[model samples]
Target: MLKLFFRHKWGPALLILLLAALVFFYNLGDISLWDPDEPRGAVIAHEMLQRGDWIHLSYNGHPVTDNPALVKPPLYYWSIALFSALQGHVDEFSARLPSALAGITTAILVFFLGARIFGTKTGFLGGLIFISNHMLFEQARSAEIDMTLTFLITAALFLFYHCYHEHYRPGWLYPAYAALGLAVLAKGPVGVIVPLMIAFLYLLARRDLKAIGKIKLPAGLLIILAVASPWFILEGRAFGAEFFFRQNFERFFHAFDHIQPWYYYFVKLPIHFLPWTLLLPAAVAYWFRRRKEKNPGRTFLLIWFIATFVFFSLSQSKRSLYIVPLYPALSLLVAEALERISSEQNLASLLPWIRGGAAFFALLLVTAGGTAAWLAATRFHDLARPVALLVAAALAGAALLYRMIRKGEGRGIVTAFLVCAFGLELLMAGVVYPSIDVKSRSS
Candidate 1:
């Protein structure tokens, strides 16, 4: 069983998703939903199902469009509604299951794209890094649109990458078109806009900006309009063109919600990337140090990462999850860097950076564990010992891994490090989450 799990083609992906599920759904229903976003979304789906009006969405019998803050499109809500049917009710588990699956499938797509462009090893490493991304893990379990949007956008971008290079396969653009439409439905125009921007910049850098023409623009646009237009058309007739302005444009340009400084992502990205953040210095040095190199896949990812960073940095409304859409590209870049470093002889020179990343992670694990216990002490004091024990186990695991790296076990370094990451993530999901949930309720 162990050998087959290791050697089978699709087996690793299932194992990785299984890890993600442990981190996502272990205590999914043990805690109540986060206010405003989670409860609001769950309630909206429940109300929509009760009303049997798929086209129109209502929260507590009120039109979601009536509330500017709640102005999300139908794709996420509809998904939650449909999935909630299994239990004949709406709640965290069912409402959030699609998001969890989307996160899993997004990792699989990363594997395919990476394998197509790089090699199987790079693809597998990249997929592992993505699924273990701290922010992705957090969002995967939550009932929200960001993971769903990130999945759709990543899918569209992956399709475009293939369609651009293999123009003979114009057929790929059809599903890419469908993904873009779903992206728009998932978030808004920005969903479509981010992909378009990425494609434009990537091609421009390649001196083949006209490759967009090969995407079967007429058919692609028709497909997008066909898939995306029906909902908007129904929405327009039901509510007028106000859906466009209120959701997309106003959120982009106006000063109403989630306003943050231009450097918001710059500040938040490190936290979002977490364990992968260690490879960042090497990733940047690898990319820009050989900037003019003709590695199409790496170049595309660099452009995607930079473009996403700058684009979201400049947005008037900035949230950490806005950059969540960019994490796959970031993960691939880190994987590429690690892969490159591993193949080099003097990997010892990079040890300082690796140790630095390890130190940061140790601090994070220690802090997360301590914080969870401290906070829970006031309300759920009984939960504190278990939380402290979990943190100790994580720290012990991390120490053993770091000791191996220090003792020249380079091969196990990456594997050992990733195990610690997985352990910390699982610890958070399984043990610490209930404490945090308790704290959130009190405050």
Candidate 2:
């Protein structure tokens, strides 16, 4: 069975899409729209439909008088409104469908990007890691701009990386620019800025200054302007500089909301990254050890992750999801690290730490499961069934992870970890989140 799957050309990608669909789409509408952001996005999309105005964003059918609705661009709302129109009403599933589809598409993009940079197996692992993580899955299930923005950014980077490797093919760069344009349409300048920064940083790291000319900045900028400028131009004509200067630029330098210390992302990133975070330290060490070598894949990925991390950390306004675009880099890095570590040559050196990390993660799952089960049994009887399902999945997966590591099944070890993590995510989606959603509303 495994041999047949390995031989098939489309097998890994199909598997990834299937798993992503299962996790992202399951119980999608079972919960109500989350307060604040989710409902804000859904309502704006709903109003867009009702008023038949695709350009001007509003809430509750009233024109947004504050500042031209600059908090987020209209693309995401446009997506939601389209989905809602298809479904004949604005419900949670339609509102959130774009994000879910983005998440799935991003997973497939990771597969191709990883394959191009790393190898086929590593690409497969990267795709699985992309979707199974806490941050991606959670965002995929929500009606928010971040996931959509993340997809656009990832798509742009993937195209950029393609152009980079294909000797800066002029034709390939156009789609990348278009993606960035849509990204800007989705969330504003940050979308364009983030990809450009990463590309510039990657080139700088490579010491390939001359390659900059081949990127055709003039043509690319025109494409971006052609796709992105129309909306911004109209927006400026209507509302002037307040939306552009204040909402896009000023918020970064001096945040009026969600202000946090510089180290905010440093603390939350680990929780957001979840099970994969356990292997991150070793992955960083692995890259550092190979830093002197001429490895563009690792070099680009390291810069991609670190540069984005520093960028978000430096922002005066901070949110954990702001850094979602960088998560794909981490996934690819971890996948490459695992591929290397799973080999017999490196397995002995890294196996102990990997085993310990696995054991500790499993212990966390067991503990969290037990606590949730106890709470469900005592204080929240409504959550009893879901809690039992979560606990059972956790316990069973934890045991499997421990056993797989204990047996020292090198390649199987990586497979085991992915399976266990994916199972946990499935249970979390199908049972845990909906249960908590119900409990929260009742409380």
Candidate 3:
């Protein structure tokens, strides 16, 4: 079964999506809605279904306010409501279904986009990395709008990239524009703003400024207006301009909450990105050494990462999840690096760092398991069985990965890392979250 993935082009894609589905949909409804965001979204969708009012946003039976619950556009609320309606009721599962679907779609998108730019193997690895991304794992299982927004942004970027490369007819631009428009509905102007900025920068970098003319800016704007304006206009008429200013403009310039130092992502991103994060520096260096080559794929990915990172870093309101859309670009780059190393490309110097990274993560996982074991022994006695099982799994994975790294087996190393990631996510879904739920209820 595993051999088929290496032997066939389509096998990896199928396997990746299946793995993503298992990780994402497993025990999705077991936990209660998390505080603030989850319950807020579920309850609002419930109310919207009851009131049959989709346009105007509200929470807890009150008119929408500038609070986090009512700050964004209604697309996510509409999604939850739609899913709930189909499911006959809104629970954790129904509330989070949209995000799970989006997460899965995003995983496949990463795979296809990577395959488009790199190759099938790199694409498969990239998709595997994305599915195991800690942020994606958490958000996909929750009722947050970030995953859905990330999906829209990723789709918009991927479609626009295809349009730019003429991989599709000019007609492709329309759906790309529609995606941008829907993204606006998902969040706000930033949804449209970020992608357009990245696209413009990419064109400018390529010195193909004339390509901008082909984008049909005027018609595209109209499409965006047609798709995103109805709810904003209706809501504006009902609530005036206050919500718009506060939610969009004010939040960016002078965020009332979640304000962080400019360098917040500098620290946060590396942590959330995990074992793959260590590979990023090597991937970047490899790309830099090859900068003289005119690789549009590499250029566009670098721009996507830089533009998204700088854009969010500059914003006053920042959360780690705000950069979820950037993970695909990162994953593709890391996958390219891994692929090159496996093929013995000019990235020989990077091999040591890659091995070191695997070893480091193996040690980290072992350490984490030990910590959990300690806590189980000295503190949470009730969680001893699951904790011990997790610890054993962690140790076994760590030992296997370390062996792969020592043997200098590039493909084995990647496979082992992914297998460990899958195991960790399984443990997380099967044990950790449920344990947290139990503790939350007990407390």
Question: TM-scores for all candidates?
Answer: 0.92, 0.95, 0.96
Any runs in candidate 1 off by more than 4 Å, and if so which? 1-9, 237-240, 346-348, 363-380, 438-443
| Tens-digit lDDT track of model 1 for 283-400 | 6666665677789998888888899889888779888988888888988888877776666665546655655666666666667666766766766676766667786876687676
* Winner on lDDT (2 vs 3): 3
Select the stronger candidate by TM-score from 2 and 3: 3
TM-score of 2: 0.95
The C-alpha lDDT values of all candidates are: 0.78, 0.83, 0.85
> If the candidates were sorted by their TM-score against the true structure, best first, what order would they fall in?
3, 2, 1
Least well predicted 10-residue stretch by lDDT in candidate 3: 236-245
Alpha-carbon deviation at 50 in model 3, angstroms: 1.0
Candidate 3 lDDT over 39-153, as tens digits, reads: 8889889999999999777787787764543667788889999989997888999998999999999999999899889878788889998888677788888898888888988
Task: Please give the TM-score that candidate 3 achieves against the real structure.
Answer: 0.96
Q: Which candidate leads in TM-score?
A: 3
List, residue by residue over 1-443, the lDDT tens digit for candidate 2. 76677564489999899999998999898888988788988888888888887877777655564644435677888899999999888999998899999999999999988888887788888999899889998999999888989888898888888988887788888898899989988888888888899999999988997888998888889988899888767755544365567776777898877889999988998999888888776666666666677878878888889989998888898989899999999999988877777774854577666776677778887998899889988888877888888888889878887888789755666677788778888887777787778778888
